[model samples]
Target: MSSRPKAKPHFRVSPAVLGPLGIEQLQDPALAVLELIKNSWDADAKRVKIVVDQRKAPGKILVNDDGHGMALAEFKERWLVIGASYKRALEKSEGGRPLIGEKGLGRLASFALGNTITIQSARESGRSFLADVNWEELSSAASLEEYEVKIRRGAVTNGTRVEIHDLKGAWSSDHTEFLVAHAEFLASVPGERFHISFKVDGKAYRVKHALATINRLAEGSLEMRVAPDGTPTIRKCVINGADEKRIVFRDMKSDELDPTLAGTRLSLKFFRRDEAARRLSGVLQRNEVTEVLERYQGIRVFRDGINVPPYGLNRDDWAGLEQQRTSTGGPTLVPGNSQLVGELHVSKRAQPHLVITAGRSGFADQAAVNALAKYVRWTVRALGTARRAEHLGISEANVRVPARIDEGKDRPRTASPQTIRAALTAISRSEVVRANPALRKKLEDASQAITETLGQSEESLRLYAQLASTGIAATSFSHELRAEFDVVSEAIAEVAASSRKPDKELIDLLSTSWGRILAFAALFKVVPVKIRRHRKTMSVSELRSSAETILGLASPDKVTTELTIPAMRLSIVPAEVDSILLNLVSNSVKAVAESTNRESGRIRVRFEAHGNDLAIHVADNGCGISRSVAQIMFEPLEGKFAEGTGMGLPIVRYIAERYKGAAAIVRPPASGFATEFVVTLRNVVQ
Candidate 1:
């Protein structure tokens, strides 16, 4: 029978299979951006405008594209397809360039950050129409088939416009931050073929050219292109403002056989940022060319003349985002082994892949050329070289061995860290695995195992540690009180011995002394404490003396110790400091009990300033905690450590927190098992 051919097991993924992942599959607002841009690109719009206004609570965003427009039937067929368009169009070389929005999901990017989404489009066929979608309605609907839509005639003459209103998921501040990130992305769009403008709170956020910093810094030019046979080759390098003085570097030889110099490639080039300004602007303006041809900034790297992994040169105004506690913050330092360099593969599909996350995950799986992974290491070295040159104008050759780390990725070999970043970066990316078959299978398998627990675990650990530390502090306080009783008894004995003078004053002193002693003993018996008379902020000098007092009283012959405190103002209640001091002294005495040279076992305490932070270090020359031990020391369960209720450090940590600081067990004073406690406090006055 002419029955349908057996279905291949390959194309098995259904929408039901993709529906379960809420955040990973859909949370990236970046995808939505790709969608909006894709649609505009598909329309063949010469100019596209992106507007973001946080002043409107949920954020008012609109993307306008002046493209060839669409017909009513075409719009119904094309615009309505979600995740289906790319499935049909991915076979071609271009991802629907004359059209761009191949992956239907790009249109939903607006929904990533907000709820209500509005789309207005006009075509050459019937008439302009507007479609409003309240995503909240989708949840209660029985199925995710084509939604019920309210369509009305729109006023636009041509092209399409999308307005995302009443965005529900976030507030205005977050919207402003998103706009700043969007501006950075706009700078990288093909300037010759694409035009984009972004306005945030009335400020023009989009810059139509390369980064001014990169422009101001570009010093030279180099280009690489694939051979007719598809072999990548690097050609001539030109020194800018140096009269086109050329330097011919041979193509890098692949030493796949030899273990040393295996996959490593060293590329050192300098560019004047101004020289590359408007590299995107088609038909470069004469004035800009002249400006670029003159003096410029330092070094930068490019893959096929397009800058990738922006080596900290482009100040995208998101620097503030990289410093705070927000998940958004973290300096945009392209890590040495990171896979963020999606610019290396500059073929037709390459550049697009670098801009989206879906494309990135695929590139990280490649075995032939883990270029992004390789190039990151190079970038780090170049950064140090750049820093040294900026500070002292020294060539990188003068630095220590500049070598790459070997991660056994792709081909087994060594690569300087900078080159690793270069290797990991690429040029193109697609969301659907089918879009890039080479990466689809692996990425899909990995996506399934992703649980919410991975990222959330950091906070979980912090809470657990906080509780454990508090419990330890309470335990240590009890140990300290028990030890203090003997000292009180000895002090009274000394006073009684001096009362043998038999004078009138001695007789009266003896009578009151017993009463005061009884009262002192009663102080510990009751819940009352002389806390009001105890703690206050003290200088380094006072802290030093307290250390000595606690040590001298604990056990003078047990072990010798040293104290190093700089003359500076410090903020810590003296009572707290005293407690910390006494605990540290007692621990040091115990550490040396079994030492061969018991007299030589030593502990040292030092307080130093690091920028605005205060670091108080307590070090010992006894047995040290191993890495495995150190990792779990802060945990609730401690190893079988004698003389330790496992609470000494936890209490130290608690005291540090009350002072708004952190405490950790570090290296001791130059011996095995020597433990160091580090307390870091913020904003020390001096």
Candidate 2:
């Protein structure tokens, strides 16, 4: 009997896989072109040129590079194979250039911009190969073998050229401009790295490299280095004459007041509008300054001198500068994202787990990335604070008290602190010792009274600011108190019904609601605490319990509370401690109450010894404060939330300061908690 040979089984790929759908992975046409340029860069090409001719219905795009090209065997195995990565084998080129290509998908990006792609490459051996992919023809084929890629071998010079025609769509002038700009930015490295030039319809388009150095023009700067263990050391530098001098200040580590910063290096430069204007006056024209400010204004991430996507985009608020400035009413002096520019450098060796997302949209959404973003936002706010402080100093120096000293008519206004101090010295030396003595006595009494008044004025202003913040919070707290009472009233009705019916569950509910009412009542007690009259050494455990007690009383079973306080004591006023706990816990409880998520809400209080200070964290699994809101939330009457009086934080701040401590909002650990405010105070034993 004769038997036919059995058909052998093998993998088959449909031609449709190489059609337009194949290039869909690249979202933007400009990005497709960029991918090609990047490939040329990875190829160690010293000179790369891209030209676009769009005068016809279907334009022609050509990219030529002088780089060592591919051989026939390499082309068949790596070039034609999708996802083949030669970069994985050789991390660097023969010329020692770090390879930027991986995943082996960049070559396919050509299909995104054109229907037909033709490539001709020659290696150092003088052997050349030509290959072309007509996606339209490939789409008609049933399998990969149905349409064969024609290959020719010949002797040619060493280089590579890619020609794309039968364009998928019309390339607008905007696209051309973007290509030119993108080419300039991508090739912003030293000339030794690569030289990339662009042309449109034979007209050479040069990118005006007018990007101003933010450090050179910055009025204030903040440089910080975060260790792998999250320890952050920051320096606040102010631009003085011919040099930037580091300004000495305590409490620089408070980015939301964190004790440590992990895994990032942030350098920020802030230019007040006027300072920017002055610096750019000689280098850039008035219109150019405006344009530069508009073009570059946000914190951008750079990995090995190349910018990562999305961070520097106009809409990206990687740093919450704009909102903080707007909400705080310091638009002129408070540098927003538009008035600030800086870089956050991350290394693959350092941040090994910080991976980029597919299509380079942004970093992969994960805990590390979120923390990085939070820290960056904090850095921006810190720089803004520094700038505002400098501005205030300038304004104070320029302020004129207009004192007549010995009542010798109107004198010229002193424009500087030194001048005013000198005038005061002269008044005391010459005017005060006159025989008449009346003017001297008058000046002496007036100076003494003014000094006392100034001291009183400072205290009064602080009190007023605190009161205003408290009043705003009172509005919200009052509403919350009333709501709790409403629940209590409903519970009373339930209890009455239960009394008649003898139902245990209704009685329990009534009891729980009553406890909540008492908790809400306890909150009011802290509000009236105007002085630290009740001073004592309190245990961290005691502090947590007090806060938990208030929360338990106010909300009952509406939210769960956890306390992880260490066995530590701090010398402070019991009432002041109560205020801090009450404000933070109440805020946490309100946050959880507002969440629409059906999951149970939680508040966590933890305390630990941090160096010579005691650190307490009041965290909650609720809608967290945004970067912007957190910046100014401590300001009197600054918060815009429904249940927030904005007074709680101010009071907390006041109490912290009174005890030689600080209060700051920190990025919460990823325990599903949204808000974490940390209070750091001296670990004084009494």
Candidate 3:
């Protein structure tokens, strides 16, 4: 029994063709970057410089390596073949190092980034060679076009160069800044002589080395990191200075170096561009670093320098993580799939279980790795959650000192940590706790005044805890707390004025401090935000005051403020009246704040009381709501300078209806102004 009849050639010879490919399909920039970097590695380059020039128009990505040059044959058949297998066959022969590039498809990566690609290589074997490919031609054809990439026999010395031009993606100021932000990864590699350069509009990329630079902008700051299974260390970092090499980690505390230091721990890296000349993780690209980061800014667990793959810090109980303050200093995992970042130092002797990767820089593909990844995700989730009750307390120490209020009432140009600290303090005090002595004293007296007012602080505290648990902020909470703080802090100042202390100057200074603190805290007041789960509050009196203020703004200036229910307060869900009030009043104020005639721009507010409802009427004598503004009052609209997001009246209407109310903008009364507003509330709350 022999095999079946001899196989015959097919009736016709079929043409073999390469499959379709697109540059846009390059999913992982890390993998694409590896392709460029690997060529240098293959050249046996001791030093390579990666430069990314993202100027105004089309950016150019250049990779130049001082490695061995390419020979003619290697350039044509081996270098240009898609999915070529030259490494396995040649490994036993020349050089004998394992090849970083096995599949030839890596060369295709340039297509994803740009349309024009050029490669230049020099060989000690002979002269340098240059090969270029225009991908537009490739992508334009219905079928694959084979272009022979041959080595140029002329010009330069031994080395390889690749430059991709005509960038597929447009460069924006944002993208340029992003590249700069990740610039730290540029010069980061230990025990290696590689340099990465980035330029935006011709300016060299740089990093603000001080950890304090981050502190300068955050409302709250905490710069701490944790390491795996070892003692941690902490070191003070002034905003723009460097630390004196006293190794610090979460596992090891104290500046004193332990001669017997062993095991894993978090290390705070202070960047010194002119000195260390090393990248934090010893990696050269942003994508490479991102590959190991958990959703949070924390890095993956590395056992002996190898990454613990799919799962990271989750499994290594002693894994590296940080608290979530302003910088990577604290542990915080925000929403969205962020870039992988941060470095966790490790060495060869870490436990076998810890070394999740199978000797490579990847994690071992086992259930443990999955568990670890999940653990990392869970830990990140816990930073703002599971640990809130505990972590919130610890983070209070990181609040920054507040800024001095300057004239003009404009907000600080930068996001100061003090701002966040003040907001937190006020929230915690009036809306959450009466820990502050002055606030505590008010609560003590409120209890003496009556039973109703005493429960307010407890209610604020209860609401605060609820917000903390759900990560939802209530708008009423801010107003309630602010008003309470304002009233209470004012009371404290009065009570303190009578104290004839041993030192009159010290007492006066304390009084000034109280006033400044109270005023600073009040500035935290913000426009209501009703994002999902967010609570926006507009109190009845606040609405009336704001509206009256705006209505009084007339060119002739006749708008004035008069409250009918001076002490009354109601909660409006959305802000129909608020929007109309803001638009009318602001217009009124603008028309009047610098008026020549209508002396005091007069705006009137009268609330007509009914059993369960009320009618609020506002009349202004300033420039009335223009037809243009009335038509689009709360709707976000695009126009010239200060063009409205148009959230005014629409938001007001939404709020009015939300709280069972109706708002209308009608033609104004005679002399003073040309605007009238009638807000009908179904049920007004006190």
How high a TM-score does candidate 1 get? Answer: 0.42
Error of 2 at 291 (Å): 2.2
Model 3 Cα lDDT, one tens digit per residue, 1-686: 88788888744211122223323334334334445665565556755655666654577877677778677678777766656757534432144332444445556667766778888876774577678777766545544434433345567576787888887765455445433333333223343344445454566665322233322221221123333432232323222232211322122224322222234433222221111111232334322322223122334344333233322222122221211111121122221112223344444334334332212235344444333333333323322221222222222334421211222456333223343333323333452234356744533333332222222332333343233223222211222122234333333333334442212222222332333233222222222233222334546556655444333223232444655654455544333344444443443444444334256666666766666676766665555555776665644321111212223344445556765777777764535656676767777645
Clashes of each: 71, 10, 69
lDDT scores for all predictions? 0.44, 0.60, 0.41
Q: Which candidate is the best by TM-score?
A: 2
Relative to the unseen true structure, what is the C-alpha lDDT of residue 524 in candidate 1, on a scale of 0 to 100? 23
Give the runs in model 3 whose Cα sits over 4 Å from its true position.
1-22, 25-61, 76-78, 83-106, 140-145, 180-183, 206-342, 345-466, 470-686
For residue 414, give model 1's deviation from the true position in Å: 33
| lDDT of residue 431 for candidate 1 | 32
Per-residue CA lDDT of candidate 1, range 578-615, in tens? 54655565566555653444666777777788877788
Q: How many clashes does the backbone of model 2 have?
A: 10
State residue 473's C-alpha deviation in candidate 3, in Å: 8.1
Best by lDDT: 2
